[model samples]
Target: MKKSFTLAEVLITLGIIGVVAAMTLPSLIGNYKKIETVTMLKKAYSEISQALKMAEVDNEFMEEWNFTAFENPDERVHHFFDYYLKPYIGTLKVCEPLEVGCMSDKIQHLDGINERPHAAGKMSFITKSGYSVLFWIHGDGTGGHFIIDTNGPHRQPNTYGKDIFRFILTFKNSSNVYADTAGYSKGLKAFGAVDGVTREELTGGNVSHAGLKPNYGCKSGLMGLYCAALIIYDNWEMRNDYPR
Candidate 1:
């Protein structure tokens, strides 16, 4: 008498539950992915900014200084991963340090290593464009640079007209910049030689090659701009923290 529910009734209830899950699961997964991306970007930005501030405070000037300025961009890339990023993440096995021999003198090509790690344990550093972002410090004393894959068109995949986010920092005041029509050269001058204006104030909106789609950053609308703003904010906090 108490066992009144039939087999058909149980199956019907289970089917209804499954249908509800199927309808809502994809949306939940997509939102989780977005949150994960935002968190990683923020962590990467924080680590880089902290390293820059520490180096800047130790040195007495603020024109534009890159954490990796010793040799070519390739070598600097290895140094960045080995010294700065490794300390923050605390897992070297994930992103094996680049071999000394693989650090080439050439700045244009960045196929230096294979299967590099992008996020901590997530995707490998392989870009859809068959290239990866290369870290560099412009020959000038500026902060640093983010070079895009030059093998293919500079925009995101399938959007030929869109621009990539290539950034240059002015060590003078930590201004973030995009590439100009004459390539990064024009952007370089705008950072170091602008005269009277700080690097923070020298950024321009008209840079052609440095454009990217909107909503690229987790907090802001664009990743490059978000990175630039975070760098400046972190630097200020560092100054206050140390108060030299």
Candidate 2:
């Protein structure tokens, strides 16, 4: 006679399955999040790069954009965004510098202790594709910094080096003898690389490299400014040792 399993046996099998799923589900979810982060980061990078190239075509090179022409920092940032970037990047909503709503008021460092206040005079907006973008002109007005939240600011893990990443717009020619020797160009570059941090150092090959600042790098316990460069260097894939 053919017989189905008894209730006791069926319950035992179900219990084992539940136990296995409980053990594996978290890991699976974490990996999926990692993949999503990487994909969004790459997409944001590509979109910004293409926007810069297109802006250059119409507005001339970034270096010639005359950021200092406007005395007020807010005005300068607005001019830069309106005349150079907005046309190409296409913002869905624009928020005045450091205004609430568009960006988080305080961005947490990767280490989770230090927090960065959204400084005054820094413009922020949401991109057409849903990323939150913030722009800050350098102190000297020579270049600007672009920080993006790949999953938008409303999402969790607003911590740096996670959903948040940084890029630099270098308008001036490189003064770094090392960067020149390394054949790095001046334009848009990932944050650490703009400071002359090499790809190897960014990817954690040599975390102590002089160009790497304390509290900054792709590794855990640091600020995570170089995490974007690390991912880019690794062909847009988060490495196995990538800090969660």
Candidate 3:
């Protein structure tokens, strides 16, 4: 007779399968998180880059890039949002509760909006040391999986600086091109290199924003294509240097 497999046999098979899944599941999950982070970074950088380029057309690109001390912080911010950024970035506002992962305020206007705890509604930029451009996109950190500040202020990796707002490209009103301010700002920093050009000679310079790996240094392994794309695009500098 065609004998059927016993329940014990089936149970044992399932147990074996479960064990294999349990072992591999964590690895798969980790990889997924890494990919998600990288993808987010890439998209953020791309959006900011495009917006900045577009904004530059109508507004005069600032000669000097500095966010050290603003003579008129409020006005400078207003101008940036209304004149410089509004046209390019739709529904953009000074991220109220900047620390909060989500952009709670939907009001298009920046007036009377509650500011960040430390920032106090003051605006900043994200860019290279010499270059000047502010790229602070608003969004919540998705469970440590996504943080704009760490990636490229607002999502685009430009340069390094203390002031989160002072990006690689300078705003028209800002002062001289501030150098090495990528890490000063309170918001997340870029998780990759700057300018899509990473060279050994430039590795440890005032301009470098290196050691920006995704997954927050939790793990080091092969990242998915999407994640790599994000890093490559957002962290232009690192992407440039990598062999792959």
Candidate 4:
């Protein structure tokens, strides 16, 4: 008779394999998710940066662009998006102010407690590449915030610093002097402004930076406004200690 493994032996071997798989599967899945996040984030960043550069060639420097021509906030946001970004970025669809389709209805905090909806009167759109772009123009029109959702609005983990990142536009001006302190030369920059800062410094355990409240730095329990900067500081790779 051919020598075959006993049924009990075969069952034991299978049980051991199952235990090992169950232990390792979550880690493998998490790593894959991280890789996917990094890839999408890099693409979105590159696309937006290149689009801005191209827009400058046609509309002149962002600092010189006149958004004050429009009185209404919504109108200014729309004009800025339509005239400066939409053409270069190739948006697939534009969502009106406070619309639900283009962006997540509620964005959660990293701690997973607090939740906030998209800003009122801000124009948002979906890019052809599946990224969600939202614009919040300041009243003075000097600059504003750009919120990029790497996986679009419908995706899960709609929390900041994970799938959602924030960028700030500072139109160079004597009154508006973020470039000098933030170490970036103006125009657009990651929210924390990580030009000359290291990852540790950028994501330090502080709750405030340069007098900005709630400090958007990549620290846990805070609004992850500077998480993009942290990733950029790490050369676009999510560090091992990256908060989710």
- Best candidate, TM-score-wise? 2
Q: Model 3, range 1-244, lDDT digits (tens) per residue? A: 9999999999999999999999999978856644554454445556655765676666554332233343444544454456545567544234432333222111111112222322333343333311222223222111011123334333332112111111232233211223322322222223332334343312222333432323212112222112222344444323423322
| Top candidate by lDDT | 4
As for candidate 4, its clashing pairs are none
Which has the better lDDT: candidate 1, or candidate 3? 3
C-alpha lDDT values of all predictions: 0.35, 0.75, 0.35, 0.76
- Give per-residue CA lDDT, model 1, range 81-155, as digits (tens): 454434443221232234221112222211122222122211112233233333444433344554322222222
Model 4 ranges off by over 4 Å:
113-115, 173-184, 206-209, 212-215
**What's the true lDDT of residue 215 in model 4?**
46
The stretch of ten residues in a row with the least summed lDDT in candidate 2 is 176-185
Residue 40: error of model 1 in Å?
A: 1.6
- Which 10 successive residues of model 4 have the least lDDT summed? 173-182
In angstroms, what RMSD does candidate 4 have relative to the true structure?
A: 2.7
Tens digits of per-residue lDDT, candidate 4, 8-65, equal 9999999999999999999999889888888988888888888888989988887787
How far off is residue 177 in model 1, in Å? 8.9
| lDDT of model number 4 | 0.76
lDDT of 1 at 27: 68
Candidate 2 lDDT over residue span 118-227, tens digit each: 77668888887888888877646557778889888788778888888888777756554342112235677777774455666774566544445545777787778878
Which sequence of candidate numbers ranks them by TM-score, best first? 2, 4, 3, 1
User: Candidate 2, overall lDDT?
Assistant: 0.75
Arranged by lDDT, best first:
4, 2, 3, 1
